[model samples]
Target: MPQERPVEDLTEADAKAELDRLAKAIAAADQAYHQNDAPDITDAEYDALKRRNRAIESRFPELKRDDSPSDSVGAAPADGFGKIRHEIRMLSLGNAFDDSDVTDFDARIRRYLGLPGDAPLTYTAEPKIDGLSLSLRYEAGVLVYAATRGDGETGEDVTANARTIAQIPQKLTGAPAVLEVRGEVYMTHAAFADLNANGPRTFANPRNAAAGSLRQLDAEITRARPLSFFAYAWGVVSEPLAATQFEALERLASFGFSVNPLTRLCLSPADLLTHYRRIEGDRPDLGYDIDGVVYKVNDLALQARLGFRATTPRWAIAHKFPAETAWTRLEAIDIQVGRTGALSPVARLAPVNVGGVLVSNATLHNEDYIAGRDSQGEPIRGGRDIRVGDWVQVYRAGDVIPKIADVDLTRRPADSTPYVFETTCPQCGSAAVREPGDSTHRCTGGLICPAQAVEKLKHFVSRNAFDIDGLGAKQIEMFFADDVLSIREPADIFTLARRDSSNLGKLKNRDGFGERSATKLFAAIEERRTIPLARLLFGLGIRHLGEVAAADLARHFGSWDALISTVDRASPAAERAVAADSAELVERARAADEGRRAELKKTRDAIWDDPPLPDGARTAWDDLIGIEGVGSVLAVSLVTTLSQPGERRSINRLIAELTEIQPPEARATQSPVAGKTVVFTGTLTRMTRAEAKARAEALGAKVAGSVSAKTDILVAGEAAGSKATKAEALGITVMDEDAWLALIGG
Candidate 1:
C-alpha cells in the first residue's frame, strides 16, 4: 500500500489525479441518490468529498476538469419519466457543518456587501427538509406543469403525481399569473411506516419512499402513497412575489400552499443558532425527517446582491446536523488501553451502514456506559444494559468517529448476559482501578504495559505531534515489534541515521523502505529537530491534556523550564488535594451518622487549606490551575504523569534530541480582555457562544471551560447560575453582555 499524501503538499499532478478519482466517485453517488433514490453514502460523507474537490479546484483552478462535481447539482433526470427543461435553474445551497462554518458564512456575506461590523443582517431560518425537490409551474392561477429538480436545468415531469398531494394545490386562489413554486415532496414518518407495513416493498427511509412513490409510472400509485409537499421557494415568477422572504412565505401560505410553520425570521446568527437548537430538539416529535436547518437572506434585494456561486447560492447556507443513527448487532466488546494507561471499551459491531459510511466498531465510552449508567450513576438509554448478540444503535459522532448511542433490549438473545468489564489490564496483568470522580479505568502498570508504551510512541509521531512523513501507525507497530534495529522510543527516531552509519544494516534494504524513502524519512525527522512548544507539550500524551490546553500553557509560560518548575512546585499540593478528597470519600461512605460525615468534610477542608508543602506550593498550584482549560484534572495529569520515573526518563531523552523548542505565538493585542481568562455563563443574547469564543480568541483572551480560583473575569448573562456564584466568591470581575460590549469598545 502507498502512503497517503496530505492535500496541502500535493503537486499539480497529484491534484489532477485526486480530482479525476473524486469526480467518478461523486458521479456514482449522485446517480444512486438522485436517479435511484438510494444513497450509498451519508449526506455528510458526500458533502465532505465535494468540499475536498472544491478546495482542490480552488488551489489548482487550471487543473480543474470540466466535469468537476463543483459545477453540478443533482444527477440528470431518471429514465422512465419524461424530462422537463427547467426555465430557471433550481438552486442547491452551500453547507455549514458546524458553528464556526456558520460564523464564517455570516462574515463572508457582510464582507461581500461591504457592511459595517455592527450592521444588523436578518435571515429566514427553516428546516432543510430531507425530501425530493419539486418545481410546480402555475399559469393564470392553475397548475400547468410540475417537475423534479434534476441536474438543475432539467427535471422529471411529475405533473400528474403532483396533483394528488393536497398541500400542493391544483389551483392557487391569489397566485401570480406565471409562478413556479419550488418546494420539497416528502412522506411523513407515520406515512412511510404505514406504507412499508401495508405496501409491497419496504423503503430505505422516508425520503426514498417519498421519491419512489412520487416517481411511479402510475399516478394512482403516487396518490395512494400519502405524499405531501411544503412550498418554500420560487423558481420562475412573472411578477414580484414579495420584497422579503418572510412576507413571501406568508404570501405563499395565503395562496393555499402549505408552508413550514417552524420557519422564523432571525435578526442575527445568534437567533438562527437558537432556532436551529429549537428545531433539532423538536426533530424527534416532528412526525417527519429533517436532516438540518437552512438560513437564507431575508431581503430579496440583498439576496440578489449576494448572487450565486458556481453551483450553490452565496446568500443561503445549510447548517447540516451530522450523525444519522442506524441499528446493527453488537458482535462483541473489546477494551483498548490508551497512552496514559486509560482503559477504554470498544464495541465490535456487525457491519452496518450509518449515514452512508460502513461501521464495524464504535466507542463504548466506559463500563458504566455499557451498564446503562452515566458517570453520575444516572440511567441512560432507558436503563437497558448492553450485551453481546443485542442490537445497538450506532452514531457517527462529528460525522467521523462511531459511538454506541443505544441498545435494543427487545432484540437481545435469550441467552445473552451483561458484559463483564475487565478488572485487570488486558495487555499486561496489572490492576485497573477506576478512580473517584473519574469515569475511565486506568492501568497501574504505567510504561511496563506494552500497550501504554507503544500507544504513547504512536501519539508522539502523530500528525499533530512530530508528523514524520512515511512513518505511520503500521510502521510504528512493525518497528516496535522488530527483533533487529527496532525503534522503541521517540529518541530512537532522531538517532536512526547515526545508528545506521554504525555496524547496523542500512534501512534502504528494508521491505517497506527503499533508498529514496529512507532518505525522505530521515529528512522529515531532521526538519522537525526544532519542535514547536505546543506540539512538544501535546506529544507527551498526558491524560486529559489536549492541543488547545497545551497551546494555552505554552503561551502562558513561554519556555520549558518555567513550565517544569511550576508543575514541580504544584505537584505536592495537587497530590494532597487528590489524597484528601479520596480520604473524605472513604470516610463518608462508611459513616452512617450525618455528624460523622460532616466531620469528615471539615477534616478534608483542613487538609485542602493547609497541605504541608513548600511555601509557594499553594500559589504555584493556583497558577497552574488558573491557565484557562487547565483545571484541577489537567493540572494533576501534568504533574503526576510527568513526575513518574519512567515518563521522566523518556521525556528527558526526547528533550535532548531537540535542537530548540519554539515558543507559541502571543497575539500583540491591546484589548483589556487580552491574556485574561474569561468564562461566559447563562444565555448570551448579544452573540452565540461560538461567536463569543472566536471574538475572545481574536482579542487574545483565554476562554476557560468553567469557573476556578484563577478566573479573571466572568461574563454573566440572563439566569446566571453556579458559575456566577463561584466567580463572585473568587473575587473575579463579573459583567453582563452589554457591559462586556462597552468594556471592549465595540
Candidate 2:
C-alpha cells in the first residue's frame, strides 16, 4: 500500500515496480466491484488510485508496463451472462479531485482547440451517479438489448434483467434508428432499505445492491427490486443526436428515457465548479447515492475533436467529492528502496477505515513530505513534520494506501524526536546520495546493487520480452541466487544448459526443478534464440527505451547489427549534441549579460538543424533523429547505452547468443511505394505533415523528416527548401505535390 514516488524522483525500476503493483491492485479492485458487486474500496479511493497511476505514467512514459491498469476499463462481465460487444466503446471519465484540476481541464480543452484562454466555451455539469453503468441498445426505436459496461469494448448482456426496470423504455418514439442510450442503474436509499428489510438478502450500499439486483439471472428477482435508470449519455448512434450535449440529453428525454433533472449548462470553469458544489450540497437530499459530478464539453463536435485516451474521454471529467477521513496513530515510518534505489517513506498506521475501506498504511510520498515541506520547499501542515507515535488524520484520496493529511497538535507525543531520513541504503551498505535538484536519495550502486540487478534481469525476460514458457519470476529469482551454473544475464540464459553439463550442482536437481522441467526451461530459452529486433531492443533494458521507441528504432534500423552500427557511429556526435543542448541552459547560470546568453543558447539549440560533426556521425545522428518516432531522447538513450562500457559489453554478449533478429515487415507489402524512403519538404497544401507521414506509412513507405542520401523520393511542396535541392543533387526523385499525389494514384 505504498504511495507513488514523485515522477521526477522515479527511476526506471521504480516506475516498473509502481506500475506492476498498481496493475495487480487495480485489477483485483475492478473484479471485486464490477464482477462480484462487492467493492473493496470506495469510488473516490478507486478513482484516486487510477488518477495517481496515470500521473506516474505521464511522468515516466517510457516505463509504462504491459499490465498497466489504464489500458482497460471495468473487469470482464461476471459469469453466467452473455457477452455484448459495444460498436462504439463506453469509456470512463477522467477524475478531477480539486478545483485546480477543474480549471486545468478547461485550459487543456482550449489549448487543444487553439483558442484564447478566455474564449467562451460551454460544458454540461451533471451529478455522476454512484451505480452500475448500463448500455441500452435500441434498434429502429425498439429496445434490442441491454449490457453492462464490462470492459469498455464489450459487456454482459442483461437484456432480460434490464427489461424489469420501469424507467428503461422498451421502445423509443423519436430516437435514432440504432441508438444506444447509456445511463446509470441505481436504487434509491428508501428502495435499498426496503429491499434489505423485505428481500431475501441483506445489502451493503445502494450501488452494490443495485448492481447485484440488475445482474441477477432471474428476471423475477430484478423485477422485485426497485431500480431506477437515469439516461445521461449515449453510444453507437446511427444518426447524429444533436450539435451540443444539452440538446442530446433533451433528445434522450424526448424518447421516454429519464434524464437527470440536476443536469445544467455552464459557460466556464467557475460556472462548472459552482454547479459541482451545488450537486455536492444536493447529494444529501437526493433519493439515490451520488459520488461525484461529471462535467463534459457541451459541443458534441468539440467532444469528437477532443477525442479520448485509451480508456477515457478527453472532453469530460468526473469531479469526485472528498473521501471520508479518520484519525489513526502513526505506528512507524519505514523507508523502502525501489528497484531504481528510490527511497520511499511509507507510514505504518493503526488500522482505520476511510471511505468504507480498511486502511493500515499510507504513502508518505517522500522524505520531503515527511519533513513537512512540498517539492517546492514550501511549508505544509503548518511546517510540522510527521513523527512516529503521533496522532494523524488519514484520508483516502482514491489510492490503495491512504495518505496522512494532518497531525493532531494537541495529541502530540511528548517523547517524539525528529525522524532522520536515511542517508545510506538499508538493503545494501552503499551510500544513498541525494543529487542537487533531485527530490530522491538514490543508491549509486547501479548494477552492483542486488535490488536493481535482479529486477532488471526479471524484466528482461518478462512476458513482453523473451517470454520463456518454463521460466517465471519465481524461477528467475532462484536462478539469479544460484552461485554455480547461474543465469545472471539475458545471454547467460542461452548458455545455461551447456554450463549445467559441467556444474557439480546441476539445475535439474535444484528445488522446484526436475529433469523434465529443467530440460523444458532450456528448450524455452533456445526457442527465444530468434527474436524480433524490437523485442531484443526492449530486452536490452536501456533507460528511456520503451516498447514503442524500440519498435520505431527497429523498423527504422531493420537489424541488430544495423542498430549497433548506427548507435556506434552516432555516439561521439550525440555526446557533443547533448553537451551543446546542456550548454543552452547552463549558459543562463554563467556570464552576466542576458543578450549574450540568449545568443549563445540559440547556437546550441541550432545543433539539431545542422550539427557540426567530425565524421559520418553527422549523417548517422541526422538519420537517427529524423526517423519519425525515434526522437532525440530515445536516440540519446541508445547512444548513451553504447557509450557505457559495461552496458555495451552486456549487450554484446546478448547479441552473440541470439541466432536471428527478425526484420520488420512493411504494413502494405503490395503497395506501389512499399519499402521506399520518402521525404516531404516545405508547406504541404494537400495534407498535414502528420497525415502525409501516416499515408506514407500505410503504403509501407518510410517517411523521413529531413532529406538525405537515404531519401528515394522527395515530395516538394510550395517553395521547396534546401532539402529539395539536396535531393535533386543526390539524384533522388524530386516531385511536386501533384506528381507525388499521381504517383500513388491519390
Candidate 3:
C-alpha cells in the first residue's frame, strides 16, 4: 500500500477519503477481535487506526461517518451466546497515569465533596487485573447467570462457561437474594503457558486466553481451561453490603468468591502510592497479569454522594503505569467536523510502535495548535511549527488519545510546506467562521449541512436522549443514505414508519433488516413518542444544554408548552432589553445632562424589573436565569436555539407528532424544606456554602442566592448581613445554620 499522506498536506477531500478507509478497516478489526477470537492486527495497530479516525472526526466533526467506530464498544455479541441487559450499568473508570495524577485524583475527590484539607478520608486500593471483566448474578443463593461487561450495559450470557471455572462458586450461603458480583476472570501465567503448549490453538496473552475460554461455544472447552476468578465489586444488590469498600470486599470473600489477596486500605495519598509501588513490584510474582492499581473511596456514603459521569464513576479511578513513546513521521493533516459544527484538525502520522501499540495518528487540536501556539497564543513545542514529513515523537499514556510530544527537525523534508486551514465547510460549502475569542471554527450551514443533520439525528437517538433500542448510529446512517428513513430533524424520526407505510416494499425487506427486527425497531421508535421533557430537550442537541441543564429547565418550566411559550416571549424581550441597556450606556457617556441619562437608565432597568407574566406561568426569564447552576451564558444559548424560526417550527412540528411531553415529577413534600425557597446568608463554619446549598437542594429545597418577597426561609450563619434583614422585613422565616439544619433533620 502507498504511504499515507502527511497530515499537513491533506486537503478536505483527502481527509474524507482517508476517513472512509479508516472506518472500514477499524470495523473489520473489531469483528475479528470480538466475534472471531482472532485479530488481524496487534492491539497497538488497532488503537492507532481508532485514534486516527477520531482525530479526523474531531477536525471535521460534521464529516463524522455514521458507522464511526468511536461510538461503538466491543463488537456485537457472537452468534452463539445469548444477550443480557444489565440492571445497573457496568461503567469504566478514568485513568490516573503517575503519582501526581493519583494525588490530583484524591484532591479532586476532596474538592468535589467540599471537604477541608485536614478532613479524614480513606481509599481502597487493589491490583487492576489485566483480564476480562465478568459479572456473576446470584438469585436466592444460587448462581443464575454470568456475563462479560460487553459495552457496559449489555453483555453475552456465558453462564455455562462460568460454571466450568473452579474459582466461581455455584452457590453462595450468605449472599443477598439478588446480587451481581463483578470482577475479573483470568488465566494464571503458568496456566496460560500450559494451555498454549497443550491446546489446539495458540494464545496471545493471559487476558485473551481467559476471554477466549469463557466465550467458547462448548462448555467442555471452557472446563478444560484452568481459569480463575476474583471478585472486587458488586452490581445490583438487594441491600447494602457494608459501610465501606474495604469491608464490602471482605464480605464478598466470606461468601466463597475468590478475592484478590493484594487488596489494602489506604488512609492517605502517600499510603496509596506506597501500596501502588509495592503492588507494582509484586506484579510479576502474582501468577496473574495485572495492568495497574485501582483506587476507590472507602466510604459507601461518599461514593453515593460522588455519583457518576457519562461513562465512569466519580468515586473511583485507575492509576496506570507510565506510557511508552515512539518516534514517527508526520504523514499528513486532516480536518473533521462534529455535530455541533466544530472544525478540528488531526495529525496523520507514519505508523510506528509505541510501547506495545502502533502509533499512526495524534490530535492536532486546531489551527493555533498546529502553529505551535496554545489557546492563549503562547508558544509551545519550543515555538516550532509541526510540518509535514518531519519526524515527530508520539506518546500514549493510559488514555487512548495519543499526543505529539516533540519533533526531530533533522529529519524534516526540505520541500515540505506550512498547512493552510480551511475557511469553508467541506460538506455543504458553507462559510466556516471561527467566533472571536473562540478556538474552534464552526460551519454556518446549520441543519442544511448533511454532516450536521446526520449528527443531530444520531444524537436524538443517543443513550441519554430517545435511547431507541434498535435505532443506533449505524442504522440511522444506513437509513438516511438510502432515503428509507430521511431524518432531517428530530421530528422526522417519529414519522418514518408512517410516511413509508404506503410503499409496497417495506423496511423489513431491505438489506440488513429482517421482518422481526424491523417490526421491533418501529415499536422502539413508537414507544418514545411520549418522552420525558428533560430527555426531549436534551435530544434536541442544543449547545451547552447537557443532561443537567435539561433537567433544570424541565423542572423550572414544569411542561413543554410552558417552556416553549416562555422562550418565545422572553428571548425577544431580553434582546431588546440588552439593546436598551447598551443605548443607556452610550447616553450616559455622551449626554451633558446627568438627569436625562439617569432617567434613561432607570427606564431601561424598569422594563425588565417587574415581568408581566401571564397567570399560571410559574417561570419568567429572570427565574430561568436565576436557577442555581443555569448561568446567563447557558440561558443565552438556549434562547438563541429557540429564537431561530426554522428551529422553532421544527420543534413545534416534532411536538405535534408526539404524545404529551411529561414534566419531571415534583419534589417530595415529606421534608419540611421541600418545595420551599431558601436563602443562605453570611459565613458558614460547619460546611462550605456550596456544600450547604447542595445538602439543602438534596432535601428538595430551592436554594436561592438572594432573599426576595417570595423567599420561604432564610438560613443565617455567622455575620448575617442584609439578606437576613431583608428576609425578616418580608416576614420570611429566619433561622441560624444550626436551627436550619435541625429543621431539615440534618
TM-score of each: 0.55, 0.81, 0.76
- How does candidate 2 score on lDDT? 0.81
**315: Cα error in model 2, Å:** 0.8
Off by over 4 Å in 2: 7-13, 60-67, 398-400, 457-541, 546-565, 582-586, 594-615, 627-633, 642-746
Worst 10 residues of 3 by lDDT: 1-10
Query: Model 3 over residues 68-92: C-alpha lDDT tens digits?
Result: 4554445667777899888987776
Q: Compared with the true structure, what per-residue lDDT tens digits does model 2 show for residues 622-710? A: 88988766667778877987879988788888888888999866578888888888999887776656556756777889887778788
Candidate 1 C-alpha lDDT tens digits along 1-746: 01112344344433443454465567778889889998887777677667667666655543443335765788999988999999888868777777877788899888667666789899999999999999999999999999999988889998999999889888888788899999999999999999999999999899999999989889999989998899999988989899999999999999999999999999888888999999999999999989889999999988876676557777899888865779999888888876656676777888998877888887676777889887678898888899989899887633224667787777789999889989899999899998776666779997689977787777677655666878766778877887765788898888875665641346777779887887788888888889888878876766556555677788778899899988888888989878887888788888988779678978788887774678778788878876655777678878998888887998889899889999877764799888887889998876666556656777888887677766788999899899899899989999999999898776
Off by over 4 Å in 1: 1-123, 126-291, 295-330, 353-355, 369-386, 390-418, 435-439, 502-505, 580-605, 608-612, 670-697, 701-744
lDDT of each: 0.79, 0.81, 0.76
Whole-model lDDT, model 1: 0.79
Q: Report residue 645 deviation for candidate 3 (angstroms).
A: 1.5
Q: Model 3: runs farther than 4 Å from truth? A: 1-92, 118-120, 132-182, 200-204, 211-222, 233-259, 265-267, 281-285, 298-313, 352-361, 398-401, 469-485, 504-521, 576-619, 665-683, 688-736
List the candidate numbers ranked by TM-score, top first.
2, 3, 1
RMSD of 2: 5.4
lDDT score, candidate 3, position 181: 98
